[model samples]
Target: MTSGPDPAEEHSADVAELLALVARQIDMRMPEIVREMRDLLASRIDDLGGDPQLVEMLQASIEGNVTTICHILANAIDLESLQPTTAAVEYAARLAQRDVPLSALTRAYYLGQSMFLRIGMDEAERLGVRDRVKIDVVRDIADVVHRYIDWILQLVTGVHEQERRRWWSTRAALNASIILKVLRGDSLPLRGFASETGYTLTQTHLGVMAWSDLDADDPARQHELDLLLRRLATAVHSPAPPLITVVDRSTAWAWFGGARLESDALARVEELVMAVPGVRVTLGEPGRDVGGFRRSHEQAAIARLVALSSPRYRDRTVVSYSDPQVALVQLLTKDSTTTATWVREVLGDYAAAGEHARVMRETVAAYYATDKNAVRAAERLGVHRNTVRQRVDKFEATLGARGVDPLQVALALRIYDDLILDGGDVLPS
Candidate 1:
C-alpha cells in the first residue's frame, strides 16, 4: 500500500477534473443549451408548451435546472445538500392547478434530463479529452444528472399531487363529485347530498345543459358560463339558486329546483336565453322528486344531442324538450337507417333529394302540423292556399297507393325533416 498510488483513485480524480472543465465550458454556452432544451421539451410535451404563460414558466424552470446541474459538476456539490429550484417547484404546482396530468410533468423532467446528459457528453467529447478520460467523465456526469433528476422529480411529483388533492378537495369540486354521482343514478343518501349541495331532490327539477363553442380549458370561459346559469335561474324565478356542475370549460349542467317555466314565463325565459350572445341551452321537461331529477337530466341530454344534430335547432339559443315534434323526432330517429327506410316508404317520391320532393315534404309537414287545414298550412309555409291544396293533392295521391295511416305518415315526415336539417341523405337509393 505504501509503495504505490491506487490506479482507480487516479482515474477517478482525472474524470472529476475533466468533468469540471467540461461543465465550465458548457456553462459558457448556457443560453444556447437552454434554447435547445426548451425547444426539445416544447416539441415533446403539449401541455407544457401550449400556453404562453406555461411556456414562460417552463423556460424559467429549465434555466434554473440547467444552472443547478452545471454548478453541481463544476463545484463538486453534495447531491443531498441540493434543493429543487423555486422556479421548477412553482412550475409543477402551476401545472397541477391547471389540472394537467402528473405524468406529463414527470415526463418533462425525464426528457430534459436525457437532453442535459447528452449535452454534457457532447461537451466532454468536444474538449478532445482522451477516449478513456471522456468515457469516465461522461459516465460520472450521467450518474450526477440521473441522481439530480431523481431527486428533483420526487420533489416536483409530490408538489403536483399535493396541489391536485388540495384543488379537488375544494367546495365546488366536492359538490361536483356528489352531483355527478347523483346524475349517474347512484343510489345515494339523498338527504345528505341535498343538504350538502343545498338543493332539494324532492322538489320539481328542470334540468338544463348550457354550452358554447369555445375552448374547454379556459377557466375564464367556465366562470362566465357559471355566471350565466346564475342569471338564468334568477330570470326564471327559481325558488333557490340553481345547482350547476361544470361539464367542461365550455359546458355546464344545471338543475332548477322548485321552478318550472310556466306558460306566462316562457316568453320571458326565451327572451333572456336568446339575448346571451354565444351560449346554447337545452331544457328538460319538469319532473317531480328523484325520479324526475334523473328523467329531466336525461331529457336535457337527449335534447342537446337532437338539437346538435338538427340544423333548425343547432343555432337556436334555447332548445326545449317541449318544443314541437322534438320528442317524436327523438323517438323515431333512435334508429336512423330504419327511420330513413320508413320515411321513404311513407312519403314515396316525396322523400327524394330533389327540390320538387323537398317542397312536397315541407308542404305536407306544414299541413299536418296545422291540423290538415290547407289555409293555415299556406299561412305557415308563406304560400298561397291554392298552392297548398295542389301540394296536398299530390301528397295524398302519392301516399294513397301505399294506404298510409295518417299518424304514421306524420311521424315519418318529422324524421325526414331532421334528416334534411342534418344535410345528409334523406333516404338510401
Candidate 2:
C-alpha cells in the first residue's frame, strides 16, 4: 500500500495550487489592472500621455507586460526562458527616438513591477488561502516577477542606449548640434569648425529662414523646401552649397555665402519661392565674418517673427530684414499690447477702424515717404495736394495738444496698417 504523501510534497502542492489560483484571478482582472496601470503612469509621468501615437505605444507595452506576467504565473514558465516582449523593446526604442530620458523609462518599469506585485498579493489574500500558504504564494510570485523585470530591464537598457546613440549620430543630428553651438557663440577652433561643418565663418553670409503653411509632418513639403533652398543658393551663385539645418519638420535655417546679394538676387529668390504653394521665406541683411553670421540669423529670426505675427504677411511668401518698416515693426512688436496702446495714444483717432482711418493712414504715410512734401505725397496717393495737406494736418492735430513725437507717430501708423488692421479688426487694442 502507498504511504501517505510526505509533508514537504503536500506543502509544495498547496503553494502551487494557490499561485495558480492567484494568477487566474489576476487574469480575470487583466482589463482593470492594465487600465489602472496606464492611468497611474500617465498621472505620474509627463512623457507617457497626451500624444495619440505615444498613448498607443504605451497601451501595447502595458498589455504585453501584464499578459506576460500573468502567463508566467499560470504556466510556471522558467524565469531563464523569459525575454523582453517585442512591444516592450519597441516601446523603449520609441522613447529613445523622442529623447525621453532613460531614467524615466526605467522608473516606469519599477512602477509597473510594484503595481503587478501589489495586485498579485491582493489576489492571493482574496483567495482565502491559509496564512502560511498565502505567504508562500506571494513569495514565489514576487521572486519570479522581480527576476523577470531585472532580466528584461538589462536588455531594454542596452536597446535604449544603442538607439539613442544611433539617433544622435545621424548626419542631420550631428550637423544640428554643431550649428547650435555656433549660434550660441560657444568657443571653437575656427579652422576645425569650417572643416567639420563644411561652412566658412569668415565669408559673407545671407541668413534665410524657410517654412511652410502645410502640415508640419509632411516629408514631401520638407523635401520641396530643401530643393527650393538649394536652387536659391545656386541662383545666387553661392561659392559653396547652402548650409541648411532643419529647425523642425516644416521649418529650416539656411545660409547662402556670397560677397553680397545683388538687388536682382532677392527678386529671383522671391520668384522661385512663389512657385511653391504655402511656402514662405525670410531673409536677413548680408553680414560679414562671424559677427555677420550670428547677427544675420538674428535678423532673420526677427523677420520671421514679424511675418508670423502679421495677418498681412501671413499669405505673402517672402519677407526681408531690409524691407520697409520691418525693422521698426520688429522692435515695436516686442511688447505688442503696450505697443498697441502706445500706438493708440500716439495716433489717437487715426488708430480706429474704418475707411476714413485707411485713407488718413495712406495720406500720412505717403506724406512721410515724400519728406512731408504734400505735392509729391498727393502724387503718390493719386489724391489732391490739398487733401493730403488736410489729412496730414488733422493727423498731427489728433496727436493731441502736446504733439506726439513724429517718429513715434510714424511707427504707430506702420504697425496699425500692417498688423492691427487685419480683417478690418484691431488686435491688441
Candidate 3:
C-alpha cells in the first residue's frame, strides 16, 4: 500500500516554501519596504543637516543593510563573515572624521533593525503560508535577527571607536574654533560647514554651560567632561550631536537642538550628575535662528553665572535659564560693577556672610513676593510668622532706619539669593 504524504516531510516543505517566497518577494518589494523606512526616519533627515546628498546616502545605506538580511533569510548566505558592505566600516570612519557623534551613527543601525521587524511581520503575512508554518518562520527569523543585531553593533562600535580617536585628536582645535565662531554669531556662511560638522544652525537650539570648580590641569578630567557631553546627547535623542567648546579644563559650552528638553533626557541628566563628579550644568530655553542661538547661549551663561553666585544654589547639579529668578537676574543685572555695587549697597553684611545670610536673603525675597505680608511669607517659606517677622526686622535694621524701598530691597535680595556671583560666565563666549 502507498503511504500518503508524510507529515514531517509536509511540514518541512511548507517552511522551505514560505522562506523561498519571502526571499523572492523581498527584492521585488524593496521599493515599498525602503519607502516605509524613509517615512519612519524622515525626522532624522534634518538631523543630518537636511543635506540632500547625505540624506540620499543614508537612505541607500539603510536599504543595503535591510537587503543583506533578506539574503540571510533566503539561506544563500551565512550571517557569520558576511557584511552588508565594507562601506559601513568606511562610512563609520568618514562620519567620525566629519565629527558625527558615535551615538548618531549607530542610531542608523537601530532604526534599520526596527524597520526590519515591522516590515518583516507585514511581509510574513503577505506570504500566505499556513498559520503553523508562518509562526515558525517568523519566530526563527526573529531569533536570528536578535543575534545579527548584537554582532553588527559590536562591529560598528569597534570601528567607530577606532576612527573617533583618530578624528578627535586631529580635529579638536578646528571643531572648537567652529563652535566658538557659531556661538559668537560671527557672520559666516555656517550652512556650508553643516555637512562637515553634522550640527545644524537652522533648528532651534538648547544651550548648555558646564563647569567644575576643581582642577582644570588634568587632561583626563577634560576628557571625562567630553564623555559627559556625549552621554547628554544620547539622553536627549541626538538632536544634532552636541557641539561642545572647551573653554578651559574647568568649563565647557555645549549646544543641542530641539524645541524643549525631553523629560527622559532631563531625568537621565539627573542620573549623569552622580556618575560624573564635580560637574555643574545649566541650560537655556530653546531658541530659534542664528540670533536666537546667541541669545540661548546668553541665557545659559546667565543661568551658570547666577547658579555660581547663590550660596544656596552653589551645590546645585543643574540649573535652567527658565528659572524666573535666573531670567530676572540676567535681564536686570549686566555689568560687573553694577552687579557688585547693588548687592553691597542693599544687603550690607548679608552679601559677604555665611549660610544664615543666605537664608535671610531668601526670607526677604519671600516677603517681597508676599507684598511684605509676614503671614504669607511664612506660609510660603513653611516657617513661623514670628521667624519671618524677625528676619524681615533684621533685614530692615541692616538696610538702615531710613530703609530702602521694599521693591528695591526685594530685587537686590532676590539677586543675591540667585547669586552673589562675581562676573560669572555672564558674557557669552
Residues 1-429 of candidate 3 have per-residue lDDT tens digits of 998999999897777667667766777888888777766665763444455655566667667766777777777366776864665666667666655666777676677677687666777898777788889878766766777777777887788777876566445566677777766667668675576566778888888888876667765566677778777767767645687776765888888876457777788876886677788898887888777778888888888877765554667898888777777765654564566577677778777656787788788889889888999999999999999999888878887766778777766766654444443323221
Q: Which stretches of candidate 3 lie over 4 Å from their true place?
A: 1-162, 184-186, 212-224, 245-251, 262-265, 327-344, 347-366, 378-401, 418-429
Candidate 2 vs candidate 3, lDDT winner: 2
- lDDT (Cα, tens digit) per residue for candidate 2, span 265-312: 888888999999888999898898888888999989989988888665
Highest-scoring model, TM-score: 2
lDDT of 1 by residue, 1-429 (tens): 476988889888887888789888888998888888888888898878878898888889999999999899988899789888999999999987775778888899899988888788788878686798888888889988998998998899889877765653364566789988887888888789888887888889998999977665655456566667767777667878788776655788899887668775666667876766677888898899988998999998889987877655766778889886677667766776677777788888887777888888889889889988999999999999999999888788876756857798787776676755444464221
Clashes of each: 0, 0, 3
Error of 2 at 39 (Å): 66
When summed lDDT is taken over every stretch of 10 residues in candidate 2, the lowest stretch is 420-429
lDDT scores in order: 0.81, 0.81, 0.72
TM agreement with the true structure for every prediction: 0.55, 0.56, 0.54
TM-score of candidate 1 versus the correct structure, residues matched by position: 0.55
